[model samples]
Target chain A: MERRAVFKSRWLPYALIAPQVLLVFTFFYWPTGAALVWAFTLEQPWGGGSAFVGFDNFAAVFGDPLYWASVGRSVFFAASATTLAMGVALLLALFTDRQLSGYRAYRFVTIWPYAVAAPAAGLAFRFIFASEAGILAFLNQISPGLWNPSMNGNQAMLTIVVCYSWKYVSYNFIFLLAGLQAIPRALVEAGAMDGAGVLRRMRDIQLPLLQPTFFFLLVINLTESFVDSFGIVDIMTGGGPAKATNLMVYKIYFDGFKGLDYSGAAAQSIVLMVLVMALTFVQFRFIERRVHYR
Target chain B: MLYRERMGRAARIALLAACGLVGTVAADAQTRTKFDLWQGLSGDLGERVNDVCKRFNESQTEFEIVCTSQGSYDAAVQNAIAAYRAKKQPTIVQVFDAGTLDLMLSGAFVPARQLMEENGYKVDWANYFPGISNYYATSKGVLLSFPFNSSTAMFYWNKDAFAKIGETAAPKTWEDVEVAAKKMKAAGMECPLAIDFDTWQWMEQFHAIHNLPIATRDNGYSGLDAELTINKTKFVDFVKYLKRAHVEGWAKIKTRATGATLGEAFASGDCQMTQFSIAGHGTIVKTSKPGMNWDVAMMPVYAGTERHNSLVGGASLWVLQGKSKDEYRGAAAFLAFIAKPESEEYWSTVTGYIPVTKTGFAAMQAKGFYDKPTYKGRELAIQSLTASEVGPLTRGVRLGGFLQIRKEVTDALEAIFSDKMTVEQGLAQAVERSNATLRRFEKTYAGKTLP
Candidate 1:
C-alpha cells in the first residue's frame, strides 16, 4: 500500500519549507554563483569595475608552483587526519560497546571534543606543543631543542594534524558507536557456536555489518580534513616554519583576505569546490558498492 | 472603564510627543556636525586615540568627533577598503605604514592638505619631520596624510646585563652586536639577543642605516615599476649573519606563539638585547619589572657605511572621499587641532612615538617632557629617524603589495634560519616572488601611474 500526507492546498507545503529554501538560496547558491562569476573575471583591487578575463585567473592559479605544493600538502593533511581520527574512533567505539563501568560517562567524555571549536582546539594544542612554557617545553628541557615546532617543519605539520584529528575523533565516534550497538548479539552467538573466538567473530560478522557507517564516517571525515584544516593550520603554525602546513584552505584565506587578490582567491576556491565534488563523486561510485546498508 | 482606558492612552501619546519634540529641539540647538574616525588601535593605543577625540570634542562646540578602534592595523585597512567599496567609509581612517601605498593608490581619499586648505585652515606643512612627511607625500613633494604616531627602529639593551658582562656601551655596529651577543651568551644568558617576527627591524632598518636601496625607482617612490633590489644589496649578508647567530645559540626568534616580545625576555633577564620599534619603549616601561634598567640606542649599521636615517614605522591619518561637507570640515578641524604642539606632546609623551613636527618636538623639549625617568631613551627615536638629511631611499619605501612582500621575506628568512634553504637561495626566491607580485599590482593599475 502507498501512503502519503497529501495537502489540500499546494501553497501549504511551499509555505512550510519557505524558510529553508530562502536560506539555502540566499547563503549557499548566491555565494557559489558569485564565486563562479569572479572565477572567470579579473576584479580591480579597489572597487571600480572588473574585466572579463575568462579562464586567465584559473590559468594563473594552475601555473603557480606554490599552489601545486599546497594541493599536495592538503591531500596529505586530509588523509592522515581522516585515518588517525577514524581509526581511534573505531577502537573507542568497539571497546565502549562492551559492558564496561560508567559506560554513559565514557560515551559523554568521548564525544566532548567535537563540541570545541576548531580554532580554540588548535590554540590549546599550540600551548601544549609550544617550544617554550609548554609541555613540549619541559620535554625540550631534557633534550635541548627536541620539540621546537616553531623551527621544525615536520613538527609543525604534526601539531596541525594532531589538533585536527583531536577535533574530528568525537564526530566519528558517535556514528561508529551507533553502528556497533545496532549489530545483533545473535550473529556473534552464531559465530561462537561455530567455534569462533571473539576476535574472529568480530572480524567476519561485525566488521562487515558496520561497513555502511564506516563508509559514511570516512567520507565525512575526509571532506572535513580537506576544508576545515584552515583554522588549525592558521593558529598552530600559520602555514610556516616555511609553508610546512600550508593547506589549500589556508592558502585560499591567506591569498584572499590577507593578500587581497580577489580574483585569484576566487579562482582557487572554484578549483577547490570542484576537487571536493569530484572526490565525493568518486567515493560514492567506487566505494559505495562495498558498503552493507543492512 | 473603556472611557478611562482611552483617556490614559491619549495622555501617554501626548507625553511621548512632547519628549520627542524636546529631543529634536535640543539636538538642533547644538548644531554640531558629527564626524566618524576609524582607527587601528586597541587597548592602550585605543585609549590614547579616544582621549584625543574626547579632548577635541571638549575644545569645540561646532563639531563632534567619534573615534572607533578596529582592533588591528591589517583589520582596519581591510575593513576600510571594504567599507569604502560599499560607500559607508568613515571620514578619517588611520592606515599603518605598510598600507600607505595601497591607500595612496586607492583614489578614494582626499589628500589631507587639500581637505584642510579647503576648510580654511593653514598648516605649516614643512614643520613635519622630513623622514615622516616624505613617507606620506605625493611624488611631487606634497603632503598627502597627517602623520599621527610615527616611530623608527632602535636597539634596546639591559643596563644591568651589560654591566654584568663588563660592557658599558650599547652595540653601534653589526660586528659590535655580534661581539656583545657572544659575551652575553658566555655570561649565561639563554636568549642573548631576541629577534621579533617583524622583518622591518632587519630589512628596512638595516638597509636605511647602511644607505642602501631596497628597491629600484628610489625604493618605489618614483614609479610603480619598482623591482625589489634587496637581493642585489647586502641584505643577504645580514640574513647570513642573523642565521649564524641563531645557529650558534646567541639569538632566539620570538614569534607570537612563542611569546617572543623582547620586553618580557629582557625583564626576566633571559634576553640581554633586542632590536625593535622605538614605540615599544612605552610598553617596556609599563610592563617591565621595577628597577629593570634599560636604554635605547641607534640601530646597528654595517661596518663600512655611515649610519643614515631610519624610516618611520607608525601610522598616519587620511581623509577618505565621499563624505558630506560638514563631516569634512569637522575632520579638518580635528586634524588641525591634532597637529598643534600641545596635542602632539600629550600623545608622544603618553605613547612612545615621536612627535612628527619640529614645533611639537621643541615644545616637548622646552617643557622637559623627556626629563622623567620613564621617558628615558625616548628621544633616541627622534635622533635615529633624523640622524641625517632624508635621502631618496631613506625617505621611505612605497610599493604596492608590500604587506605581502614583507610576509614573503619573513618566510624566506625563516626557511633560511631553520636550515631548510640557504640564505642566497631564500633571498633570491623572495625577490623573484615579490617581483611577480609587483608585476601583478602594476597590471592591476594598468595605464595609471603610481603617485
Candidate 2:
C-alpha cells in the first residue's frame, strides 16, 4: 500500500520526462549506433549501398604511420591545452574572487573571448600569427628578428595553446567562481582564526571544496581540446608549415573529405571515440569518488 | 472560470487547424520545380554565377535553378556526396578537376552529351578546346561536364620588384627564374619566388610541362588500373631542383595548405615572383594597391624538354541524374547560352578564364579585347595552352580514386619538405599508398567503367 502511493506520486513526473528520453534515444543513440555500423563497412561509390569489410579498415588505419602520427598530435594538443586552460582559469578565478575594486570590469573583459565564435577567434589568431603580413610578422620586423610562431613548431604549438586557453578560460572561470562562492565563509574564517595562512587555507579548505567543479571542468576541457581544436587548426596553420599541426580530427577530415578514404577516416573516428570514452570512464570511475561536491 | 476555459479550448483548436493547413501548403509548394545547383566559387566568382542565374530565371518561365555556393571546390564535392546520400542532391554541380574521377565513378551524373542530346539542344562537341574538353569528357568522346571557367598556370611578377632588382624582362625559362631569384635575394627581397599549393604547381604541373607521366596506364584515362610513376628520373630531378631552391632560401614554402595567394603576396611586395593560375588576374588587379606595377608572363620552362603546356585548374558544370526532362532542358539551355561565342567572350573578358572555343577567342580578338595593356601577356597563356603536347602524360590524369591519390601525394610532399622523409622515400611511399587507395576505389566501383 505504501509502495503504490509512492509510485502514484512519481507517475506524473516520469510521464513528463518521457518525451526527452525518446528524443535522446532517437537522435543521439540511433546516430551513434549507425556510426559504429558505418565504421565497419565501405560505402558504395555510387551511393545507397554498403558492404561489410570486417576489420580491414581498422587494420589499414593501425598500419598507416600517418594515422598514428595524427593520433599522437591530437593527444599532445589536448593535454597541453587542457592543463594550460585550467591553470589560467584557476588563477583568474582566485584573483577575481578577492573582491578588489574594478574587479567586475576585469571579469567581464576576461570572459569576452568566450563570446567570439570558435572559427572567428581562430581567424583572428591566424591573422595575428601569419608569416609575412601578420601582426606577429610586423612585430618581428620592428624588433629585427623576433621569435615567429609561423616558422617554428614549438612556437606554433605554444601560440595555439595560448589561443585555445584564452577562449576557454572564461568558461572554466565561471565554474571555478561558482565553486568558490558555494564554499561556506564560516569555514574560511574558522581556518584563519586557527592561524592558517592564505596558502594553507587554500590548500586545505578551498581546494578540496572546489574539487568537484575542477573535475567537471577537466573533462569538459579535455573533450573541447580533443574535438574542437580542428576549427582552430583549420583556420590557423591549416595543418602546415608542413603537417606539424595536423591533429586527429583534422586528419579524419582530410582522409574522409579531401582524401576520399572514408574507411580509413571511419577507423580513425572509432579510435578517437574509444580513446575519449575510455578517458571519460576513467574520470567517472576513479576520480568521481574523490570530488567533494558539498 | 468555466466560460474562460471553454473560450481558450476553442481558440487552441482553431490555431492548430490553421497551422496544419499552412504546413501542408508549404510542403506542397516545396516539391514543385525546385532544382538544386551547387558551385564551389565563393566571393566574386559566386556573385557572377548568381547574376547569371538571375538573368536565366528572368529569361525563362518554366524552370527555377536554385544555385548555392558551397565554399571551396573540395567542400562542394563533399556537400554533393552528402546530399546524394540524403536523397536531396542538386541537379547540376560544379566539380573541380581533382574530383573528376570521383564523380565519374559515382554513376550518378547524366553525361552532358546525353543530357543535351535528349533535350534537343544544338551542342557542337567539336567546338570545345580539345585539350581542355577531353579532360572531363567520356571515353567515347562524349562531354561529361560543360567546360566552364577553364584556366592554365601562368607566371606573375611584380614589375616594381623586378625593376628594383634591375631585371627588365620576364624570366623565360626555369634557369632564368633561378637567376632572377638570386638577383631579387641580392636586392633584399624576402621571397623571390614562392609558388602556391606547392605539390600542384611544383610536381604535377612540372611533370605536365616536361611531357612526363605522373602515373601509369596513360595517367589513368585508359582505365581504373593505374600506378604512380614518380620513380621516373624527371620527377626525381624536379624534386632535387625544388630542394635546392628551398635550401638556397630563394623559394619559401607557404605555411598554409591552401597557400598564401601568390598574386596577393606579390601585390603586397612580400613576394617578387610566383607561378599561379591565370584566373587570379581579376583579383590581382582589384587588390593591387596604388603604384604596384605587375604583369603576367609565360610559366617558366625546363631547359632541355619541350615547354609543354599546363592543364586547366577550374570547375566544370555537370548535369546530375534523376532530374525532370524540363529541368534537363533548362540546364542544357543554360550551358549552351554560356558556351555561345558572344557569351563566352563576355565571360572571359569579365573573369580572366580562357575561352573554351576557338570561335570565342576569335570573337574576343575581333573586338580587340586582347589589345588592352592589362591583358598583354594573357594571350600567351592561351597560346601556350594550345601548343601543349597532349602526350600520354600531359593529357591529364584520371583514375578511380584520383582525389585520394592526390591527397597522398600532398601528404608525401609535406613529409618530404618537412624533413620527415626523403624525396625518394616519400615518392616510393606515396606510390605504394596511392596504389592501395586506387585498388579500394576500383573494388567499390567495380561494375562501372568508361564506355
Per-model TM-score, in order, reads 0.90, 0.90
Model 1 chain B is weakest, by summed lDDT over 10 consecutive residues, at B1-10
> Best-fitting candidate, measured by DockQ?
1
Error of 2 at B318 (Å): 1.4
Model 2 accuracy (lDDT, Cα): 0.77
| CAPRI rating of model 2 | acceptable
Candidate 2's DockQ = 0.29
- Backbone clashes under 3 angstroms, per model: 0, 0
> In model 1, which regions exceed 4 Å deviation?
A1-18, A96-99, A178-209, B1-32, B257-259
Pairs clashing within candidate 2: none
Interface RMSD of 1: 1.8
